[model samples]
Target: MPFVDLETNLPASRFSEDFLKKLASTTAAALGKPVDRMVVLVKPDLPLFIFGSSAPCVVLSVAGIGVTDTAEKNRDNSATIFPFLTKELGLSEDRIVIRFSPLEPWQVGKNGTVVTFL
Candidate 1:
């Protein structure tokens, strides 16, 4: 299954319907699956770090979010992130792994402080 985890400084509102549609189209094409068969999960992770490896590598880990409850959804979510990871960041998709952690606000904490937008 394709899996994608995105950690961006951008706000959730920025992910408009048009963007989702485009993402669905692109992801379906990449995965060789129907658009409806794909699943996508978008999370807003502010104050995050997107680091680079020694030789153009990318690793994304997202916490405190949940997407659809299906393997296809997970795969589609992962596939959707490839374009941005490759084009925007100049990193190969093969080097990246997107994982979703269905975590509660209280469960994910940094320095004993639970970070939440609510």
Candidate 2:
């Protein structure tokens, strides 16, 4: 599973209901994971400041098993996501920050149990 949490100072009205689905799809495709297994949480209107200003900045965190384990893969993922974020959220490149967390299967829980995908 790939979990993407997006926290932004922008208002919720900035996003359409379908935005999450599109984002989940984009992230899953970028990571070569199943879209159904991707979870995207958008927390808008949060008090997030960048460079001492709260001018529509975003803090996006991504966690997944095997998807974010390498530097090259992370770069590739950033290459894919950066444009999407800028175009979709209308945010400048410098206004967004993304953190990737690589996780082991055992560290995740599903269906009241722990499992491995590989």
Candidate 3:
């Protein structure tokens, strides 16, 4: 399972839905998983502040199996995601913090069954 959840103080309308679609494809390529299996979520319009500043701060949590295996992988994923945020969200690169989390196979359930695909 690959999930990219974004929590931002900015307006939801400021983002492009197409970015999630593209992120699904890019994340699939990075994880060697099928694009259909990815889950992308966006929770904007939240009351968030970073470093005591309410300007525009985005906290991104990217969870997946076999995707965040190393720091190098995290850096690579950041490279892949950063440009998109700059272009779509119009935020500076330094305003975002991306965290990578491990997603175990047994944690996912689909269609009344637990599926294990790592």
lDDT of each: 0.53, 0.90, 0.81
Residue-pair clashes per candidate: 3, 0, 0
lDDT tens digits by residue: candidate 1, 1-118: 2233454545667666776666556655645556674455655435544444344344454332344345776676666767765765455676556655555555545555764533
Model 2: clashing residue pairs? none
- Compare the candidates by TM-score and give the number of the best one: 2
Model 1 spans > 4 angstroms off:
1-5, 52-118
Candidate 3: misplaced stretches above 4 Å?
none
lDDT of 2 by residue, 1-118 (tens): 8999999999999878689988998899899998999989999999889877888899989999899999999999999998899999988999999899999889988888776744
- Superior by TM-score: candidate 1 or candidate 3: 3
> Whose lDDT is higher: candidate 1's or candidate 2's?
2
TM-score of each: 0.42, 0.94, 0.86
Most accurate candidate by lDDT? 2
The better candidate by TM-score, 2 or 3, is 2
